[model samples]
Target: MVCAVIINAENKRIKLCNEIIGLMYGYIQWNSYDTEAGGIILGRENLGNDNLIFEFITKPMKKDIRTKNRFLRKDSEHIEFYKQLYSKHNGVYAYYGEWHTHPEDIPHYSIIDLTNWRKISKEDPKEMQYHIIVGRKQLRIWEMRKKCFMPKLVCEVKWDEINI
Candidate 1:
């Protein structure tokens, strides 16, 4: 399993499991025809610490909107999956944030991405959320606090580093 850890400037850490990372890697925009794909991030917080361990993520469903440059998660299955995990795990598992693909060598959050993330931060029950953008060669993660106006860049993981 591809185990990876990312620590932000604020000393907050996030662990990405192999399965979820692998699934995300599959949706990287590799070709011209490739479109964006995205889903929600679900995981648990480490007790007595600010660290997080991401264990699950929903995959793109038929109801989702996909385009070469945009991805809108319109599927109800993602929420259903999150509900199931939260229920099965008895609240240990929770929503972390959103993830999507960007057809670039190095990804940066677009205006739309920022707007949507801010909306999520305000609406999601969790006080902290993490958003990930998978690029052609790397993945960038951002951390957003519900009370904060802007999300901070947590860390960036390169595709080569994962060796997938």
Candidate 2:
């Protein structure tokens, strides 16, 4: 586990003790929800940047467009709610990535997942990134810097505890 403070790369593997790391890790731990669909968002302030903690994340509770419609539109309610969150946070925060549940056991991706990731990969490719796939036993994350999405093998992650 790399123990340091780097916000741009959201995929920091650390012992589950720190609150920020633990929160992200903990949020990914729950696979009990019938997340017919969901998404992950990531945000963080540059480390050592005063008290202004530039950290945030957003996930839209989605419809069952059949096992996580990653390309689906965001409902207005989610949009508005996020707007409020952003207003309160005062802009240091960013919408980094998303989390969702699938009907698999080992937390893998589907063809659709690859498609969605491709779009994200096209955007910046170096900024902070986020992703979550809740399978039967674990949740996986896809946080590779500047790598285009690979539908067949999108990300390497596992149950809150990342597979770095």
Candidate 3:
């Protein structure tokens, strides 16, 4: 059964996101919640088939407040930063959702994770958002549907495809 949102990304983008997430794990371990990185997932959406092709990603703003294993908070400044980036790109990119890292070798979503995704879905009922949790060696994806998050498959990736 499908348990996470299907993510279709280029190999380089996936590699980059994974690398950044891995760095977060190291930072959390070395410095304790002082650093975390995340940003919008940019891609094409085939609404008719419920498929998404994520082509690019953004970096989280420096102002975000991250915890040991959670993206605890994001201030308005960070939101504005994303908005500006999206706007400047001439609508090519959108607020697809979020991606963050965890410290565990196999991390699972927490209550806070569900709550945040639910909140975003509720606030933006018309659009479907996604959330990705990158663990040391595991990647989990969730799609917001009808005010909730659902797991889906990682359908495809680019060159030298690495099936997570």
**TM-score per model over all chains:** 0.92, 0.58, 0.62
- Model 1: residues >4 Å from true position, as ranges? 8-11
Worst lDDT 10-window in candidate 2: 2-11
CA RMSD per model (angstroms): 1.5, 6.6, 7.1
Model 2: per-residue lDDT, tens digit, 1-164? 51223222224431122333334443342345443545445354446542223244334444324333233535565456567777886854555555565555677666766666667767854543456565555545565444634432334434434432
**Which digits, one per residue and each the tens of the lDDT, describe model 1 over residues 1-164?**
56655554466667888888899998999999999999999888888987788888899999999999999899999999888888888889888899999999899999999999999888988787889999988899998998899888878898887658
Clashing pairs in 3: 3-151, 3-152, 4-151, 4-152, 5-152
Model 3 quality (TM-score)? 0.62
Model 1 worst lDDT window (10 residues):
1-10
Q: Measured by TM-score, how close is model 2 to the native structure?
A: 0.58
The alpha-carbon lDDT assigned to residue 153 of candidate 1 equals 86
Which of 1 and 3 is ahead in TM-score? 1
**Backbone clash tally (model 1):** 0
